[model samples]
Target: MVVQTRADVGDKSQERIADVLRQRFADVGLDLGDDRIRALAAEVAGA
Candidate 1:
């Protein structure tokens, strides 16, 4: 299991989280772009 702190995600802002996620996804061979990642992060945050 991978454990992550808020700082690992680049703070608690949804936008920042999305940015980190975009790069991470790319690192894992996922082509999820910034726009989609940001949108998904926002949804997760709102939930």
Candidate 2:
């Protein structure tokens, strides 16, 4: 779980990381599609 909302960071990179995490979670049978998981991941990974 990671999100980069830094002013110096790009949105695309952040999105890519998130998408990877989403996929990873799905692969492991986790529910990354849930808004709560996404929000938590955003907080944990975002700046």
Candidate 3:
């Protein structure tokens, strides 16, 4: 459901959400852990 929610958002909105999620992961001690993945996600979101 969360993945779907992310997927459904507009590109810019998705990037914003992704940023927030990544930050949250960082705070929790296990980040999403890949710059490339984050960049791809951002690019997809920004598409």
Candidate 4:
């Protein structure tokens, strides 16, 4: 899923959000890798 946030969100915050999302997805049996989630997070963060 694409997570859109305010452009002001920092890179580190985006990464932390992505990490949480990764774990949540994993808990549901979806194994979206770090690279993919990180990319999505960055993309939405407008990085």
Q: Pick the candidate with the highest TM-score.
A: 1
In terms of lDDT, the best-performing candidate is: 4
User: Which runs in model 3 stand beyond 4 Å of their true positions?
Assistant: 1-12, 34-47
Clash count of each predicted structure: 0, 3, 1, 0
lDDT of 2 by residue, 4-28 (tens): 3233232445465456666767777
**What lDDT tens digits, residue by residue, belong to model 1 across residues 1-47?**
01242336533688767766776677778987667777767654553
Error of 3 at 3 (Å): 9.9
Query: At residue 7, what lDDT does model 3 achieve?
Result: 66
Instruction: By TM-score, rank the candidates, best first.
Output: 1, 4, 2, 3
C-alpha local distance difference test of each model: 0.61, 0.53, 0.56, 0.65
By lDDT rank, best first, the candidates go 4, 1, 3, 2
lDDT (C-alpha) at residue 20 in model 2 = 62
Candidate 4, run of 10 with poorest lDDT: 1-10
| Cα deviation of 47, candidate 2, in Å | 1.5
Q: Candidate 2: which stretches are off by over 4 Å?
A: 1-12, 33-46
Which pairs of residues collide in candidate 1?
A: none
